[model samples]
Target: MVDADQTFVIVGGGLAGAKAAEALRAEGFTGRVILICDERDHPYARPALSKGYLLGKEERESVFVHEPAWYARNDIELHLGQTVVAIDRAAKSVRYGDDGTVVHYDKLLLATGAEPRRLDIPGTGLAGVHHLRRLAHAERLKGMLTALGRDNGHLVIAGAGWIGLEVAAAAREYGAEVTVVEPAESPLHGVLGPELGNVYAELHREHGVRFHFGARLTEIVGQDGMVLAARTDDGEEHPAHDVLAAIGAAPRTSLAEAAGLEIADRAHGGGIAVDERLRTSDPDIHAAGDVASFPHALFGTRLRVEHWANALNGGPAAARAMLGKEVLYDRVPYFFSDQYDVGMEYSGWAPPGSYDQVVLRGDAGKRQFIAFWLKEGRVLAGMNVNVWDVTGPIQDLIRRGTPVDTEALADPRVPLGELAGRD
Candidate 1:
């Protein structure tokens, strides 16, 4: 049992770590809580970095998870701008910052999160090459976008994933010319497949966002340390004042790997491996959020989700597990995106080849539709674009894992909750 003398250390100042600290206190744990973050800013949600904040629609303070005074009021030690250099598992302590200060923990939670995959090509170090991952990156990009918009500059973005697409939308809204280059055949091809991916392509195209499919960005052409254009393997050079590398993110697992903690393989979305209860190989240590790869009972697969919802929910779940409570962290994989005028919420894991058929409901042309990925008639994942209030029912169907009539599933009249047998 955890006592007042025991200290719980949480590494990472993202949503997962912040929520875990909040959970620990809410769970009646009187132990000392220390949250260590490498970033100088307080724990903040990242979705706004590409959406509202990037668009200048939301205030800077709105992104923080808690007020500055909340941490002190709750007696939670906040270590900002401090990086944990090493984890001495044998000593149940972590060495952090340049001074190598040591903090002992009876229990530890690793929520180091993920970092944007950097471009390995030439000219990546140019002045106008950017990647959005942290608050600082967003702040810089936001100012750049405003300047780019005022100057009517062209922005070439690599990758058509969520981040890239969202940034593209924001750039277009800023009145900047945006071009997205993706190796895939369509936007979000890996997630929505060609059928629904086409919808996003059309949506963005209508908003003056250009798409360059079936090519990978090979180099960022620059002059005098400033980006000039982006060159793809297709032998095409797209003029660009700025280039945003939104290829993807890799889980930050170096600390865990160096500490000899079990790491998940690339096939399982590589990260620190954890069980259903979020415990790592070492019983005293737990991992959560974008840094944790855990078994999903519902999907019958190991998953490492890097979405906002995962971090929001995973932290508390890991905290409960750390408190010795029975925790089966089987939440459906979820993520949402706001691009142009289309807002979407996706639930469950249904990567390409995992689902055989995609059933669509409502109208795709109108950008109001629900696309369901099914395997042998069983719902594996669902995404609602410009649709509302059906996430719970969609997740329920995925959890049921039972075959459903595709016709009923596609029928807008047939309630999703009825198909899931929730009623």
Candidate 2:
């Protein structure tokens, strides 16, 4: 049980940290909750930055998880824009970045999210080359979008993952001519596999987005200290006014490692290792969100998820665990993305080669379908593309671990709810 007098410190001010703070208060713990964030603003929905926020469809205030006033009303202390340099586990304190504002905590939660992976190529440090990970990045990209639209600037993207594709959609919406170069044969080839990825490639092609597949970015050429073009290994130079690197993100785990916490290896996605209850090596310390490599109960494998849903749910679980509660953290992994006219929601993990076949209901070409990845007739994961209101049923199917009839799943006449007995 918590002492009800000691302070609870949460690092990383993203959704996970915010939710953890909320969970502590909601659980009737009268202890002090201090949320330390590197970002200047309060917690906000990061996924919106790629879509509504980036497109100017949502106001800046609407992006926040809770307004600045809400934190004070809830008696939660906000330490905004404080960069944490180190964690002294023995001292039960955190050292601030260079400025030296040290804070103490009885129980610590590391939610120190991830950082965008940088390209090793030359000229990447040029003025117009950028990577998106925070609100600052979005704001810069938004400003660039405005400039690009007015000047008809060319935007070159170095990846075709969710980030790259979403940015491409938003940039195109802003009237920037976009070109995406990927080392893979199609967009999201690593995630959705080649067949489904091809469908996305077709979607992008229809929207006047050009893709250079099987091309490796060799250099970011610049002139006058600003980006000019992206040169690939195939001896082709694609002209660009700006370049966005959407390769991937690396989990921020230096502090955890420094504090002697167990960390997973690179092959395991290299994150702070946590048990089923989200507890780290130290009994008094816990970790969640993007930095946590947790043993997923459902999949029976250690995995670290960077998606919003993981942070949203994992935060509360970690907080409860800290308070001596039963914490399983067995949520079926879920994530959604919007690109052009296609909207998709996927539940459960479909690790590479785990699913033998992909079964589809409706039409992939029409951008209306529910794709199911099956392992020996047991549904491993399901994705709904341009289809709405079926996430509950899809998640339930995964939790039940029941073998499904492929014929029924492929039949649109059959209701999705009937397929999942749990939901």
Candidate 3:
């Protein structure tokens, strides 16, 4: 039933791709495994790029998913710095690199990941304009932050999302001036909503970070090919020596699109549409991580998560599914953020309009609390700030899908386990 002569080709060199290769081997697959990555660097986790590494608290080597020698030892054919230009689904092969070399595969996996969205405004091409996505980008930004810190330069950031806010915290730690321009009224409004978003706003404000809310960046004013200021649509100019665009990232779907794969629409988080088994429209091909939008039986909707944990768990699950193992990926969506002195972990999906009420546990003023978004009386999502070791219970509350009492949920004396219908 198993073919040793078969070859499994994986596209994309991010965390998901690398872990899939590891899982294939762990699953006792003896077939040839080829992993192609456009980046020359080894497969690395992305969280560090915006957090520890950017803050100079993590070593460069700590970001890699595996040691450099691990691939060779595992017999994985790693094609670093190579781009797969085209996929031939009918031929079961891919055209890669400038020479157009083709590699055939019996099975394929796409973990192509995403790229930072670019600013269409003027002066984006100028010096001192930066984005933090790749390790190289973090390295460059780290150097820039050091220079800005040393010279007391003002760094203007566009977007108040996770990346923008994390970078702002790192900039403040480096003693650089930071001004964040966000279209939303509060930081993380799209995710945490206004109530908790205001908490982050206050946290950053306490650290001397300036926020210009309810405005979009109109242009990055520059002179002599270097940033000078950022102008907002509200006709206000914010002085700056550098600009960081943390607007967000868009899924890289060109290869899948060209191959005629069924891609999910924007309303469902645009990505290659995959089934519960991570199988795409083409049965021979599969997708995982940020690029694959798959149905969540628990959430009752198709979701595409761009966080590190998805890649950490999704790859192995996809690999097992490829190995003819029964797979049902219903893991609760999870993500965490660290800004200034506050750290938080969020579980489940509770976007605006999806929840009826937000209940709080512990102290909000002290930045130590758990915020729960409830639909009717059922727990939909929970975020713990400056709180530790409650991710398990929070996820349990969401997965159980049972109504929880707000009074018991808010009472600090009540054990979280007792509230989640657990013994």
Candidate 4:
């Protein structure tokens, strides 16, 4: 048990850090807690930045998790615009940027999250090329979108992942001609598999969004410090006024390594390794959210999830463990994305090449359906596009490791709840 006045220092004031701090206080700990964030603003939801927030449909004040006054009331110190440079485990303190202030902590939570990856191709440093990872990036992109009016400019997205596709939908909604360049055969092929990827390709194409699959980009070309076009490996050029690189993000783990903590092998790029209790190799320190690469019960191997759900759900789990509440973080992974008018929801674990049977429910032609992935006889995961009700039953089946009848799942006449023996 920790002393009443023991300090808890949390790095990276994004969703994970913010939620962890709140959870610690809610758990009845009156200990001193400090949250360090590089950004000036308090914690705000990021998922809306690509959708409602970027489109100007949602106000910034509405997206903030809590007002600045709330932090004051809770006695949680907010270190805005402060960057933690290194962690000295031996001294039990962290070094921040030029402030000469070393924060001492009895327990430390590293939620230092991830940043969007950038392409190293030529002309990447051009004025019109940008990566959407933070609120500042979204604000800049929103301004650029306003400058380029309807049917006047073209926006080229570098990747076909969720971020790139969501941005593509938003750009299209703003009346800009949009094109997505993907090196794979289909969008989200790496994650959703080819069948679901085809559905996404069809959905985007139906909305007049152009996709160049199996095309490898070689370099970005610019003139007068502004992006102009992207050249492919096949000697083909595509014109663009603005370029958004939504390839993916990498974990911010430099401080953990600098502190001489054991780093885990990279599952999805290079993320920090942690146990089921969210404890790092150093027992005094814990890692959560996008930075922590954790072992999945379904996959039988460590994996790193980039969804907002992971950050929100996993952060508190780590905090509880630090407070001596022993529990394994085994919640089924889930995420949602809003693209155009479609809302896609996914749950459970789907390891690559682990599924033998795939059951499709509802009508994809009508733009509403759910796809269930089964390994052997048990349900492993399910992806629902514009179908929200299917998530609950699928999640239950995944949790119980229940064997679903493929025939019942594929038939729209039968309710999904009946297949899992829930109803």
Error of 2 at 122 (Å): 0.4
RMSD in Å for candidate 3, one decimal?
0.8
* CA deviation > 4 Å runs, candidate 2: none
Tens digits of per-residue lDDT for model 4, 1-423: 876879999998888898998899999889999999989989876898898898888987876777889898999999999999988888889888666689899899999999988887888889999899888898998887876655479888889998988888888777777889999889987778777888888888988889988886678899899988988777888898888898889888988988877777765446778889998888889999989988877657787888889889888998898898986987788989888788988997775587887778888787698888888878888888887777788888888785767787788889878777688
Q: What TM-score do all the candidates reach, one by one?
A: 0.99, 0.98, 0.99, 0.97
Measured by TM-score, how close is model 2 to the native structure?
0.98
lDDT, candidate 3, 250-292, per-residue tens: 8999999999999999988899999999999998899999999
Clashes of 1: 0
Global Cα RMSD, each model: 0.7, 1.2, 0.8, 1.4
Over 4 Å off, model 1? none
In order, the Cα lDDT scores of the candidates are 0.94, 0.90, 0.93, 0.85
lDDT for each residue of candidate 2 in 1-423, tens digit (9 for 90 to 100):
687688999999999999999999999889889899998888987998898899999898888888789899999989998888888988999888557989899999999999999999999889999899999999999999999988999999999999999999998888899999999888988678876899889888888899999997999998889989999999999999999999999999989988899998886788999999999999889999999999876777888999999999999999999899999988888899988778999888886577898899999889999999888888888999989999998888888786889999899998888888743
Candidate 3 clashing pairs?
A: none
* Tens-place lDDT digits, model 1, residues 1-423: 878999999999999999999999999999899999999999999999999999999999999999999999999999999999999999999999989999999999999999999989998999999999999999999999999999999999999999999999999988999999999999998888887898989989999999999998999989989988999998999999999999999999999999999999999999999999999999999999999999998888899999999999999999999999999999999999998778999999998989999999999999899999999989999999899999999999999988999999999999988998878
After superposition, candidate 4 runs with Cα above 4 Å error: none
The clash numbers for all candidates, in the given order, read 0, 0, 0, 0
- Candidate 4 or 3, higher TM-score: 3
